[model samples]
Target: MLRFAPSPTGDMHIGNLRVAIFNYIVAKQKNERFLLRIEDTDIERNIEGKDKEIMEILKKFNIKWDELLYQSQNINFHQNFAYKLLQEKKAFACFCTPQELEIEREKAKKEKRAYRYSGKCEEITIEEASKRAEPFVIRIKKPKSSIKFEDILKGKMSFDPNEVDSFVILRADGRPTYNFACAIDDMLHDITYVIRGEDHLSNTPKQIHIRKALGYTKDIIYCHLPIILNIHGKKMSKREKASSVKWLLEEGFLPEAIANYLILLGNKTPKEIFTLNEAIEWFDLKNLSNSSPKFDIDKLRYINREHLKLLQEEKLAKLLGYEDSQIGELAKIYLEEASTLNELKNKIDKIFNEKRDYKDFEKEANILKENILEVIKNSENFDEFKKELMKKSSLKGKQFFKPLRIMLTNQEHGPELSKIFPILKNKIEEVAKWW
Candidate 1:
């Protein structure tokens, strides 16, 4: 099974969604279960409605999960396991004050040595430790040997035992630390694959130690995706507004477009665009780029436009919140002329602009107006008028409709002449009087 565990600290950002999408694809490709786990261990930073909003967005993008787990609800389970490790002599408690640890760290740095816990309280008997403990954080005792693991993507990664930090498994307040909680949760949930961002790669060695101590030797596959960076080549963050998914949503990006663009970040692809299913078929961890991918708004917009163009009129209308009846007409106009939604909106603005007058017509209108007016004035019927107009003007359909479009709708370009004419047929006489 695959799982996407996101902390509900803030809105779901684009970088986070990239990881979710990658995990979702892997699950679908392998016909395995995809689960959603809420890593809300950090209660202070939790945002209300964030989990619901994340679920809603994932649903909108068609990403599904088999189970929903909350770390906060399993506090007892984690505590029990932490205590078990302590009993087995694989973990220990330290009552070191913040100042003392900082001083030790600084001394090590000054001496160009790795800063680590000096085992200050490692030898203290349980009774003596109980007496001295004002408030203590539990730390895992690192084994004095090298640890090795095979990363699914990076491969054969190893870390020396001494280099690994003696991390806190339980806080002074009794809450489980992130590393401890993640290891316990992964084991409890039977997660076979650990797919997450590369930022968590450093924490892997520590988790491996915990897994070993707990006797979980069935090596889990770990695939760390590359980080997403801003266009300036810096790691993306909320401070960099450009990286936020909420910002893109606010700027009118369709969910499909965002999902498609995100898949391009690290995955190898020769094609410029792909549908959700196509992306799943093409997704492979081996093809992921090692370097951080830059988020480009322009490229995202281009990809969105292509997807928008391919959408069925009804779906497009539903996504854009236009009425069903308005869909066909609007889509026809959009497909025929506009390269983008903005362009279509601009044309709509021209249609509704009350200030536009006959004098605002293009120069070509002034050149052809006299002949057009004379032909209209002399014609005996609508059919005769059409025939005469077609004969006098060498313009084909587009040129023929150009003047009529400006006359009836006061717009330079829009829906096809046939479609636009039928919709504006009643206004033809009123516009003919202009010439």
Candidate 2:
């Protein structure tokens, strides 16, 4: 089994979704279970509807999970394991206060030294430690020897024994820390593969140590995916525009488009557009880019247009949620000539509702009226009308529609005349009233 655990802290960002996609692809291709785990151990930062939104987005992308688990619900299990480690002397409680730890950290920073707990309470007898009755955090006892592990993607990595921090397994409040909680959840869930961001690379060794201490060390794979960078070459964040999935969805990007573009970010193969099945078949951890991939809005738009073009006419209409009968009719005609569905929708949106006035078209409309009215009267068919008007005047669709469109809909561009003409042919005579 594989799992994608996300913290419910804010809106789901594209970077986070990319990680989920990788895990989904791996599990789906292997015919293994993919679980969704809410890493809400940081209760202070949890958002109310963020988890629901995340699940909804996953549904939108067709990312299925076998189980949905919350880390907070497993608190007791994590605490039990921590206590067992404590009894085995593999973990010990430290009564160091926040102020003392901060001072020690600052001193280490000033001295340009790596800070490891100085074992202030390492020798404190358990009885005396219990008698203190002071709030204390349980810390894992680090082995004197170095820790080494093989990252499936990055190969072998080694961390010095002294450099590793004696991290807290359980906080002073008796809540399991993120590292401990995640490890316990993975073990209990029988997750055979752990796929997450590269930022968690350093934490892998510590989790390995914990598994060893718990005597549950078996075959497990860890694949740390690369990070996604913003256009300016910085890590993408919600603070930046177009970084969040919600923002992108609002900007007219279809869910399939977003998922397709995200998959290409870190892993691009010969195939340009990929369906969910194709993604599952082609996705591999070894193929993920080592360097962070840049997120370009322009490229995203291009990819979206491609996906939009492939959608069925009815699907596109359903996706856009267009209800107007005329708009749907216009969409069919516009799509025939449009390079993509987005372009088709763009053209239809122009005249779907009341016309929007523009300054340039307002001035140009007056000069083009006499010629446009005569052309509209003379042409027998829509196709012939366009050709005749194009010959007499160099102006194409926009220029031709500018005066007539403004006269009727008060907009410069709109649904193709070929489409609008059939629906609004009666309105043409009414438009003639303005002339």
Candidate 3:
């Protein structure tokens, strides 16, 4: 089993989406069950409706999961596990106050040493703690030896016992901490594989410790993908506009194009461009690079443009609010200047919605504009049409071509009229009468 566990805290980050894509693709490649686990246990930080927003985004990306679960719903199981650890003396309750812990932390800072938990409550007996009125938190007993595991991507990893102090399993308010709940849920779901961001690397050992303490012997395959950096070479942050998947979609990026770009990042692919379905055939976690990959908007735009070209002409026309397949072909002419669906649509919209006043060459331009339909109908091609239109207006050189150009395309400069007039011939009446 594989899972993409996201916290319901904010907008879905692009990095997280990439992780989801990797997990989903790997699950398909392995023929394993995939699941989405919303770690909504941090009720204080979770935003309302964010979980639904996450589901909507997943749907947009076509990432179907076999199971959907919220971490909060397993509160009973988490509590039960915590009690089990306490009963076995593997964990104990601590009555330390926040202020008291801070003072010890400050003393450690002054002494230039790491602040390890003092384990002051390790001697507190269960019956003695049950009789006490003070609020306390359950903390797992610190491991005596190093915690080690082999990450599928990062490879052999180890953390010393001193690095992992006795950490809280259940908070004073009875809510499970992130690592505790994550470990328990993975064990409960029998998750055999975990593909996630490199930010979770440090938390892996802690989760492993939790599982070991619970006597859960099964091991989960871990692949920690490299961090995605911005163009400035800094870690991508949610504060950046391009970091949000919703922002990218609103900006007119095709979902498939985004998936293609992400899969190509930090990994070797069979080809430069491919669909999500194509990726599943060859994607392997072992092939991924450990080096961080930079998020390039220009690269994404290039990929989106290619994906656009791969669309059916009729479907491309529909995206631009047209039914004619020729209109779709006409839209492709502007691909040199437009990279996104919105930009392409704007280019097509200008053809049918622009108002041409013919102010500079009012008489000459108007004469050609008025006779455009008749001249175009009579002539089979642009050269023939231009020749006949000039003859009708008795105009030549700049006077002849400038007004004709404005009258036809409503712009003084653009793609040569020769290339445009052919595809646009059938739509001439609409273009001329648009004003």
Displacement of residue 107 (Cα, Å) in model 1 is: 2.9
Residues 344-400, candidate 3: write the lDDT tens digits. Answer: 887787778888766678878766666777888888888899888878878899888
Q: Evaluated with TM-score, which candidate comes out highest?
A: 3
TM value for model 2: 0.86
Model 1 lDDT vs. the true structure?
0.76
RMSD of each: 5.2, 4.2, 1.8
Residues 269-375 of candidate 2: C-alpha lDDT, one tens digit per residue: 65777777777777777877788899998787777767766667567676556754544555555544453445565665554444445456665566565566677
- In candidate 2, which residue pairs clash? none
Error of 2 at 324 (Å): 6.7
Of the two candidates 1 and 2, the one with more favorable TM-score, higher being better, is 2
Error of 3 at 276 (Å): 0.6
